[model samples]
Target chain A: MSTGATGRIEITDLGIEFSRNGRTVEAVRAFTLMTTPGEIVALLGPSGCGKTTVLNAVAGFVAPTAGQVAVDGEAVAAPGADRGVVFQQHSLFPWKTVLGNVEFGLKMRGVGKAARTAQARTYLSLVGLIGFEHAYPGELSGGMQQRVGIARVLVNRPRVMLMDEPFGALDAQTRLTMQELLLSVWREVRTTILFVTHDIDEALFLADRVAVMTARPGQIRDLVAVKLARPRAATVIATPEFMALKARILTQVREESVRALSGRRP
Target chain B: MAPAPDGGWQRPVRRVLSIGFFFVVWHYSTKWDVDLYVRFQNIPTPWEVLEEAAAQLRGAAFYGHILASLERIWLGFAVATVLGIALGLLIGWFRLAEDTLFPPIELLRPIPAVAWVPLSIMLWPTERSSIVFITTLGAFFPIVLNTVHGVEGIDRQLVRAATSLGAGSAAIFREVVIPGALPSIVTGLSVGMGVSWICLISAEMISGQFGVGYFTWVAYGIVKYSQVVVGMLTIGVLGMLSSALIRLVGWRCMPWLPRRVKDGG
Candidate 1:
């Protein structure tokens, strides 16, 4: 069984397609990535570059037309509790209180009420929403709602966390703060996280390695490793290393976006 | 003060005032002092109707008629709610059932609750059961339709989120589907309850041996203007009270739901 310091995920040559009005659209084309345990990898690309499709395939929401997605030596044939996902829209159930949303996973696992509440409370605290456990999701601000989304995934302690532009909806300032918050949480848990984003600075700030993808027919263009020091903060965005990484990623994104707009294949 | 966007309480107050104004206009119009076929004695004033209603309240017959009508409405309304919510959840969730059953229900929905009265009377042995059946038919469609729509309209992400978190099918339905669709379900029930009252009054009028409808019909036959007015007021007050009760139930169950414009004000 795969375990301990190295949280491994191996995806080989994945392809996904969407059927629209009897026409087949190629959404993902021959994507591939491999990372050892405890590594945070960002799938970075432009808006139309099919970055989210790859993450969905990994999370088991979408099936790849070809190839495989394996996490910690096990084939991801279906969505399991092992791979937690945070959606871009902050999909906290509006009817449920914050604690109920956090406790949902434990309940699904058939954990006792006592045990689940204890687990949920710990997770709520991790996301800095300890006092607001009984509050419903609708009462929260956008940033706070996203924090609930984050805490929900973290509590499950999955082998891999598949996040689809988790901080995309936040303002620039809040985004930076959330990025730092995520870094601190990731530092403690050391979970292998597959984070998806179109933001260049975000890709550099949070991920250990950034996997750049091409247009519609997305595939790994480059795997640039970001070896910045631990415990990253908002200030990390201003550093020379961060800017250098951001510049490289922006070039890749601009090329991909141009390719998409031209109505040409990459 | 530039009151809140919707002077929150004013709409209800306005609705009540409008209804009162209409009655006042109706009462003044009924004063056939100029030229009318029916005399002022036939079309009584609002004050005359209120006086008759107050006088009738002293009698047990009026209360008895009210109780009978209330009993049938509560019964049929209750039956429809239980069946509608359950069947709605099933039809809403399963595509095959939705396709098969929904078409027939949609076709039948346009048929008035009163239209079902003759068929129900022919089918049922007892008057009470027929009344209940017609009322159920009346209330059933709105509640079922709304519940299904509510369930269908649930945020897809919420279902995906709960399922991804490892919730089983049962938990998904209970914690996610039901609560998520609650706003819609309650809407259906409130409408169903209102419809039930409409059907109950009609049904009572058609086959009532001892209800408000029977009393009103008999009064009209004998040209008892005061009794007719009394019966009409009883039905109106009872209908309004029942609807208010249903709305109160909706409020207590779903404080999270947005409050809409109230009726009659």
Candidate 2:
């Protein structure tokens, strides 16, 4: 038995449009989506593909111009403790130490100082940052910083974890280590994760299902389930099923990109 | 890398040589009997100024005058700081206050504190209290202006982070807003010290019975040029000391703000 049988996230016919600089940008075009219980769903797309925008919509950062989003049975009206979000840029407050950042969500949830510190330390151990509790975010390397970022989001034990390009900023070696670290993290909590990324390999490696999206004014073209076995290791990268899914997602992305460049409506 | 000067008696030799150059020039010019006001013409000689300053320094009245002026400066500065920071934060945080209070403050800020000399005199019957009032007004405007700028300059993200973390208004202000606004508060303090120093001198001349400003002004009335020079030097020393004290207090309060430069400016 693996840690992959718990929470759920549901998104229905969501749409978002914004007016910036006097121009109407249809940032999200009639996005309809869902991720079932205990599943890691990856929103795969290129830059300007509205992958982040869709994540924002679901996270309650943006008002949907069209549809509905629900976690378990409740509709999200604003950012809350129940749905933890890790931004693409790692928006950890610079003034706080590693422990402080990890304890932020817990503190907001009204947990006592003693209990929050203890729980935060537990999550820190899970992410291999147990010893660096007092270190500031600026004092750590990019990968170490992101590990704190993951640890900060994970400790809350949210029903749904919304991540936007969580590893897009790391170096290649760091990215791979982070991918392994993320797998171990998922194996522990198995919270319903909607992880957004442009990296096909990362999506293949972690996600139980990958929803590859069409380019800007973005729409979901396909949501393919990755049936790869869990306790998935770094060596999973060399497997046939991994490579095969990579090829399929690549084709979907490239086709959508061409259609996007051709000025044809996606 | 600046090494120590090569000569064993370097600093003492340099100091003596500079003084020697000045006296030699003065003594020679006086000895040659140049028709021009050579050594003590309109400006007194260095020796004469020192002698008069030493004589004044020995007097109890001189210390009393210095103490009087110093008292006014501190009192006015203390009052200005609390009022300025409170008003600045209010204007910065609330849109209604910015609209209602700031325009009036801007109108009053440009009027010189000296102009308030007559106004303060009319408002208060006593000369000593009047001088204090003017000095307070002088320091108040700059403190308020800088504080408002500082409060407005706070990072928006920090505010959002606090609110999202469930911090109420009081905690947000005490834990976040004050510390975040401290660097700017220090800037305001430094500027206000300078302005108060300037206003204190003028206020002293107008209303003081015995102070450095009054001593200097009174000396000008009688033509004791050497004593006037001494009084001017005293004011400069006092001003420097006061500014240093202001910066010391600032440094103590805002330990997070970097201390790379002492703009004792």
Candidate 3:
């Protein structure tokens, strides 16, 4: 994969809090991560560990209470096309056709009709959604919808593609297919990506480095770089190197999951 | 028997039978001069009412009455649609607009449109303008309220996604807020269409000299019971047809919505 020159993401000492039910709840604290241009990093943790909060901070959907997020040294104060996000579900505009949804960022930048349409079609074809341009999001299956979501994000050629469990809602078979699809697309586009998920296999399969996170008010517990060979297939999971890394990361995640469960009880 | 499958001929057959049963009961009641406490004794027979409807259809004056009422409803409904949607979008989207505008609308809304007849008559000089004003008043609240609800109920995630996709505030409003609120806006329109008819008819009965409502009221005063029934039926048919037109138009505009399943189901 040829890495793009400009897609670096830097998040430093980020903290986030939410005021819910009249209480200030700390969701994430003292979290820091950075990626080289076109590197894939997965923030792996149990649900509610504020793994998503960190991703949201980078995507400019959430403001950090302590630190800041930067893309290519430019600080992110608000959401922009520079950081494209693929949400877990229901992110597609139900009213817009698949083509329209993919064309949205280009349209916002005032690209002409012919140029935007051609560009959108290219991205759609990349994600294997070439024939379904005119169909609405409501008509597509869950897997196809997320394909549109991925295409929509990639069409922007974003500096960082932030995925918050983008395939979390899909069935196992679909999720595997989507992971493969994402890797192939990432290889071609080579945009920086920050993926957040709780699934161990997903984290190991898709990411260059998996940053295991602590319980709520989360921080990185471990960052394990996968040394497995590239051009990975589904069969790579059975390899000793992949399994050893999974075993190491699995213990950290299990410990965090236990802490997260106990922390919620009282 | 088990329920007929959906989209079957049995359902249509049952619907036809249901209407036929009502008409049969009506024809028999009037023919028998059934004098319950409610009194069907003075009520016109179905045949007599049909004949009177045919007679009215033959007259130029009846057409004039129908046209006058229609013109008032069309003018009032059109005005209400434009203003209600504009005001609703504003009020629903921007908090400042909501705070500044919503209070007065909320205060004024509960006063029924029929109650506005006296104020409307005093406000506008022409009878036509007065009737239209009342009709507009009736239709406005529902349209504005439904639109506000629609806008408010839009998923915040959609807005976030749009913003992250490089939508400015104005672009978000046009692309996201407006379309997201459309189904509800169409609901408002359907309701507004119904309310406007009610207001028009009441206004015409009370003050108009040239509408179907006015003709019906006059027929009652002159003791033309069969013609009164005809007028009532004409109003009913027109109201039904207009509401259907709104639905048809709404359905056409929202082609992206799934056909088999109703929205919010």
Question: Number of the top candidate by TM-score?
Answer: 3
Give me the runs in candidate 2 sitting further than 4 Å from their true place: A1-7, A88-90, A106-112, A130-132, A254-266, B1-41, B44-57, B124-130, B160-175, B206-212, B222-265
Candidate 3: Cα lDDT at A217: 88
Q: Whose DockQ is higher: candidate 1's or candidate 3's?
A: 3
Task: Tell how far residue B78 is off in model 3, in angstroms.
Answer: 1.0
Q: Please give, for residues A93-130, the per-residue lDDT of candidate 3 as tens digits.
A: 99999999999999999999999999999999999999
> Per-residue CA lDDT of candidate 2, range B67-185, in tens?
88888888888888888888888887778999999999999888999889888989998877888888788888888887788778877645544444444577667656776667677
**Model 1: runs farther than 4 Å from truth?**
A1-3, A264-266, B1-27, B30-41, B258-265
Rank order by DockQ, top first?
3, 1, 2
Candidate 2, after superposition: displacement of residue B111 in Å? Answer: 3.6
> What is candidate 2's CA lDDT for residue A93?
60
Assess each model's interface with DockQ, reporting 2 decimals per model: 0.62, 0.22, 0.88
Identify the superior model by lDDT, candidate 1 or candidate 2.
Answer: 1
Place model 2 in a CAPRI quality band. incorrect
Clash pairs, model 2 backbone: none
Per-residue lDDT over A108-188 for candidate 1, one digit per residue giving the tens place of the 0 to 100 score: 888999999999998888878999988877788888899899889878888888889989998988888888888888878
Which ten-residue region of model 2 chain A has the weakest summed lDDT?
A: A1-10
| Per-model TM against the reference | 0.93, 0.78, 0.97
